[model samples]
Target: MDLERLYREDHTFFKVIVGDFNAKIGPRRTAEERHFGTHGVEWNEQGERLSKFIMTTHTIHGNSQFQKPSHLRWTWESPGGQFHLPDRRRCCSEVLHGIGPSSPPR
Candidate 1:
């Protein structure tokens, strides 16, 4: 995708990408502490892909950077009211470091 292309072309630019990636990266894993936090849902197939991309591109998962209440974590609720999904945000480490501790907006 465009992100991959951008990363391939240049590795120095400050970048921040936010959107509904439809990928569930879940909570932080053993080796993923640098990229994820402790307040995410379960991981899925797409989550693996996105996680790989984040690692490969040296990007931080913005949504997973802070601790949020379970209620505020998900961006979409199922029509049946039985499920919730997240839309993620990612940014270069440079940008991530500039941000201070805070919670996600309601």
Candidate 2:
């Protein structure tokens, strides 16, 4: 489950395995879910850590250019033990791509 470490060890093989990755793969490209992974996006420490691992692995070890934030969150419907619920953005997976110090390199 330690995706970061996995990437760190094997990123050099990405080209051989999957070819040059474009780094545009992800969710949340809609108007409503646009801020899904933005700075203000809500997440616990574990979530943040996973996000950092994924992004860093892609950028540094994999030599890839990231577009959006590679983070995620569970919606209200996915909470309280109920699998489905009305009036909820169930799969709001859009993330914000930034260019600040926090952003991944180009």
Candidate 3:
């Protein structure tokens, strides 16, 4: 029904999501804030509950299962103010981090 409910009820372990979500969330400590066009709305008490759910639910681990366990990789591509569609590959996220412009040029 809500973000807090979804993050709390449906998540068990390492629920990694990869997609184009145009909305931003909190605990606002992530890196997606430095850019422009980011819609930082009030998740409010519901958002806070959900944030807590995410923090408490996630389990940080260190194992030999994979190499390069980084959260993000830096690309030379700039944010916002662009030209073509086929050349684009990424979007802004609440958890995502970068110091660039907001939305690309249309």
Candidate 4:
């Protein structure tokens, strides 16, 4: 069976979806008051498609769920020195919401 078929059969078995989709997810706040802040985010064609898929499947953008600086957020730097985050991690809301940075030392 194809990966999608297997994935559907055992969705819980999936910890993450890893790949370089060359997709850009632009910033937006409160998707139906659900999604969080995405720094410098932009919605491209790929992002539109991904957003629709996320809405349908209740998937969360793993990277967006975190608080990272602009430099660390990108996966690639173009020859012209433009940075873009192409790699992505997709997981269900339950899994994504459960992750956050631990408290700092006093």
Candidate 5:
């Protein structure tokens, strides 16, 4: 399956995902409680898909709910003038427990 190729069971237990996710964590963590919170723009389809991806793979979205300034969270400005956080760093087990609902290391 396409998803199978996204992860590997080779000797590594930790993974750092970085790329153009083209998704937003959004401002509603109700359905995606652990991986998101109330911040950023409104949630969209990609965010919903990403929520499932993270949950299914035991991964945590880099947009932890620890509370940081909005400016630091965005990486680019949309042509429509919306700040877009199109990239993120997702992590999996062996190191997930130590994250403590905090933003990724600076």
Candidate 6:
């Protein structure tokens, strides 16, 4: 993806990409601690791909950076109330300063 290429070629500026990736990203794993947090739902095939992209590009997963109430964590819910989809945000760690559950808005 262009974003991946940008991450690989540039290091002069902080990068932050936020959107609904439609990937679960599941919970945090030992190897992905830097990029993921422990408040995710479940991992799936798409989540695996997204995880690989984040690792290879050396980006942080913003959705997992802070703890949130269950209601606030998920971005989408099924009409029947059977499923919830979490959004994903990929950013460089440098861009994450002062951004957290308690951090002031920039």
- On lDDT, the candidate that comes out on top is 1
TM-scores, each model vs. reference: 0.62, 0.28, 0.24, 0.52, 0.53, 0.59
Q: Could you give candidate 1's per-residue lDDT for residues 1-106 as a string of tens digits? A: 5878867887667887777778988888887568887777889898898988888987898887778776776656578877645544543345334344584543
Q: Candidate 5: where is the Cα deviation over 4 Å?
A: 1-4, 8-11, 37-41, 71-106
Error of 4 at 34 (Å): 2.1
Pick by TM-score: which candidate is best?
1
What does candidate 4's lDDT look like per residue over 9-102, in tens digits?
Answer: 7748455766666667766656562443466366678767766655655556775666777677665558898776655465334534434578
CA shift at 88, candidate 1, in angstroms? 25
Per-residue lDDT of 38-97 in model 3, one digit per residue for the tens?
A: 233334564444345445655211111224334442224446856466534465445645
Give model 3's TM-score versus the native structure. 0.24
Please say which candidate is ahead in TM-score: 3 or 6: 6
What lDDT tens digits, residue by residue, belong to model 6 across residues 7-43?
A: 7787777887786667888788786457888778888
lDDT of candidate 2 over 3-86, digit per residue (tens)? 445566774654332332223323333444332333333445554454455455444322223333545422333456655346
Worst 10 residues of 6 by lDDT: 84-93
- Candidate 1, residue 84: the lDDT equals 45
Better of 3 and 4 by lDDT: 4
lDDT of each: 0.77, 0.43, 0.41, 0.60, 0.65, 0.76
Quick one: ranking by lDDT, best first?
Answer: 1, 6, 5, 4, 2, 3
TM-score of 2: 0.28
Backbone clashes in candidate 1 total: 0
Count of clashes, each model: 0, 1, 6, 4, 0, 0
The lDDT, on a scale of 0 to 1, for candidate 2 is 0.43
How much does candidate 1 score in TM-score?
Answer: 0.62
Please report how far candidate 1 places residue 39 from its true position, in Å: 1.7
Give Cα distance to truth, residue 66, candidate 6, Å: 1.1
Q: Higher lDDT: candidate 2 or 4?
A: 4
Question: After superposing candidate 2, which stretches have Cα over 4 Å from the reference?
Answer: 12-40, 54-76, 82-106
